[model samples]
Target: MTTPFRWDLVTPDRLGSMLDGALAPEVGYLTELCRCAGKVLARGGNGDLVFVGRSLDSMFDLLGGALEGTGHRLARLPLSFWRGYDYSRAHVLRAREILADLGITPASLARRARPVTFVDVVSSGSTFRSLFTLLHDWITEERETWPVIRRKLRFVGVTSESKTSPNTFRWQQHADWTLRLPAASVVNVSLDRPTWSYFADRQRKLTKSFGPRRWIDGPAEIDRDDKTRQALAEAVRLVELGRAREVRRMIARAMEGEPALAEAWLRTLRSRLS
Candidate 1:
């Protein structure tokens, strides 16, 4: 019997569309940047604070070279909300979740005495303000350990966010320097631009390696059972045509009764197939 499941990866395009509605054009630069760097940052990190407040496009360009320069050691924070929802609530909640996953709470930082850098695709100062406030309290409470960890606190934001008020005050007042998009250039394109670009990029690779586009348009709803199965079947067909090694490995893992692995593959299938 097919195992029960009801989740799918929201494409970067979908994420962009969702974000366009949630934040003003200015605040959503980070979201666009996230689409370009999300997969990479999720999979890689370099141990240096190199740039801040740069455009999403420029940030992506720099990600690889910076990693290479730093000997492939880096840390990244890919801020995201729930799938297809880019609300600030989702953003803040996701940020907290990532921090929790890293065990990098304010209180924890004081005790560890490790300088931590916050890196993202966009820096509006607003986003970092809330994040930094949380850190500040944690550092303040743990005065004894503050010195050990204080020097380690750094932030690098890509792209521009509204600089209104004290948004990212710490970066302005405290950070070494904030790298930002140069004036006269479009700092942030429409939120959906990067997402669509990433999808187009992936689609091009898949099309080149396999055959023509067959899914018609992306699925309207992935919540239903039939859609999920239909989606996976399409993915299996494409993977077969492309002989995608990783997809085959996942299919093998699923066949071996690795429920989590199976679910992940299924989710990816749903996303790619859609």
Candidate 2:
């Protein structure tokens, strides 16, 4: 079995600096993205909106905060579905069990009068396709109408913009393969290519290195690296304590280590928030 991924620990001061460097400049842009996503949720009707990955969990918190008083319901349905693996009977059973525990069921879905939107950070979009297939089959087994269910389904994908190409058509094509979701229904949020690429590489490495048990387990069953969590927690605590200036200084110092990333983050902030 492959070893689990782990994050290196850093001092609270270092973590604050790192987070400031990574996200402080992007706050306005990230907040705007959250607001826009919230608006999308609002327009999708009153059905439940489910976010599907840990990558989007923190962003979902921001989005939830932005949607305050918007009368939209949001839930996180974390699951990992990589390609090239046969989902065994036991795996399917466990998935069903997890969904049940999360109160996501055919009956509950049918009760919602509005469309359901599933949000995720999309690379090839295989995870969303696999998850949709699983849920569709489950609903079908319950003798639900496919047409009605199809009509009530929506997807929101966050993707990255290639620095060289700058065109999103390739990503759109990749996501459209096999899944027949309408062009309009698959909302995409584009991020800086290099930043996105760095994270994608890390995710691929982690996925490849994870043990079989982790591969089969529901997302909640897998643990996130404690160091990263601790760092983020401390950063949030500092922010809550109203130490904005200290945070800014720390971030500025950290940004000196990667001026390119700092510039890209700043550019994204200006372009999106302006």
Candidate 3:
């Protein structure tokens, strides 16, 4: 039997003309990012998984929807560990407190003998490295476990492709930095060249339009914006109905209306997705 259409399998190329003029530029970009990210997760993920980060919650939902028939079990650990922030004593204590509250004891993780993949978005990879260290210490000091607990761990990072040197092996660099794990254990779902450039341009524009802090903190603000919420909801509805063609048409029409933005969006998408 043929597999049914799922959002995880959707990519910018597949969206085709739907991304042309049918939806707003920002909406189209967000939809494409979520779809591409979902595709990456579905392709690279293995065994049982724990996904971390608040910004990724929506993308995880898309992934979960696509993974409906797959046997993988997924858990969300909503710990907000900022990449460049200093780790104060209070932060360490709070992390321990949260781990205790979540009942992530060594016994619980080891009970089923299933490997656990840790999923997150990576820039510098400091968050996952810190998490690995914290978990290692906890398993050693509190649970009094050794190599067995460590063996069942894997890390997956969803990141954008490099702009300066587009063909560089970015994942390997990330893997080298992640502690106590083989480079192979780190899986990256990097956005394709066009998508990554488009994203970087958007970030630069947002920063210039607002400020550096606004760019850094945009996800929260975008999430709370009513228009963004509605646009995302509409995109989800279209995917559920398998109306990808309609989405394409909508994007085409929207781009036609705003020729300047449409020109830039399509130009970038063409360079990458083509």
Candidate 4:
């Protein structure tokens, strides 16, 4: 079998700087765009103004000041994300929640009888695409003036994809180095591969790369407990061997079902993946 997709790792300091640089500009970019786009939006002098996407309360607070200044109202779209999960439910709920909050009712939004501004706080733009796609399809079905509504909506914040064309909205990157998989890496992982092998390799590399940071504590400090250390080591192995399914099981077994260890195991996995 081919070797797994091992990341070209960097120190935590380097990672932090990269993340900061990538995400910092988005605040200004969104602020400018919202100011410019506010005029076109149907917010009756209150059509409907809502915030959709991840990190609701924080994004709300950031944009709330500007939105009120422009005579706009605000509603939040709550989202729930999972490890290795793609955007779907979050996208749908955001649109629905906004429509509901505006008193448009689900049937009206579904019917295209009302115009509303769709604002997305995007990190990678996947959720944005998903949201727009649903809106587009819903609008088309009603045989209404879809362009009018589409024109009123705006997407703000960070995206990860490059600008392949004018229509592309790039997700802002925070790290100096973009994580990329080597050309042959996917070949090493397969549905048939045993889970143990995956976990083993991940453990081996992560320990070597990240040093002994706490495995189960505040914002990820290196831990003093042998059990925490052992659990992290085992989790890395599962990931490496394409055994993600078993990593949680192994952690539970090792920690005798300790919640802290379980959380630490997940966070460590996220750090490695992130």
TM-score per candidate, chains pooled: 0.32, 0.61, 0.56, 0.33
What CA RMSD would you report for each candidate? 17.3, 10.6, 13.3, 22.2
Model number with the top lDDT:
2
For residues 1-274, what per-residue lDDT tens digits would candidate 4 score against the true structure?
0111112221112222222222112122222223223222211112354544322232233334323323335554432223244435544444444445556443454455324544443444455545455566555655656435443444443222232576653342321111221211111101112222222233222112211121111122334344433433333222232223333233223323223333443334323322
Off by over 4 Å in 1: 1-71, 80-97, 106-114, 121-123, 140-144, 159-274
Give the per-residue lDDT of model 1 (tens digit) for 154-207. 554443333457453433444222222112111221225444444323221101
Give one digit per residue, the lDDT tens place, for model 2 in 142-244.
9876666666777766677654555545455665433555555555555555545544454222112222255464222223354444435533443332223
| lDDT scores of the candidates, listed in order | 0.35, 0.51, 0.49, 0.33
Winner by TM-score: 2
Looking at candidate 3, what is the lDDT of residue 215? 23
Q: How high is the lDDT of residue 223 in model 1? A: 39
Off by over 4 Å in 3: 1-45, 100-103, 163-179, 193-225, 231-274
Better of 1 and 2 by TM-score: 2
Q: Candidate 4: global Cα-lDDT? A: 0.33
Candidate 3 lDDT by residue in tens digits, 186-215: 767666555555443432210012222322
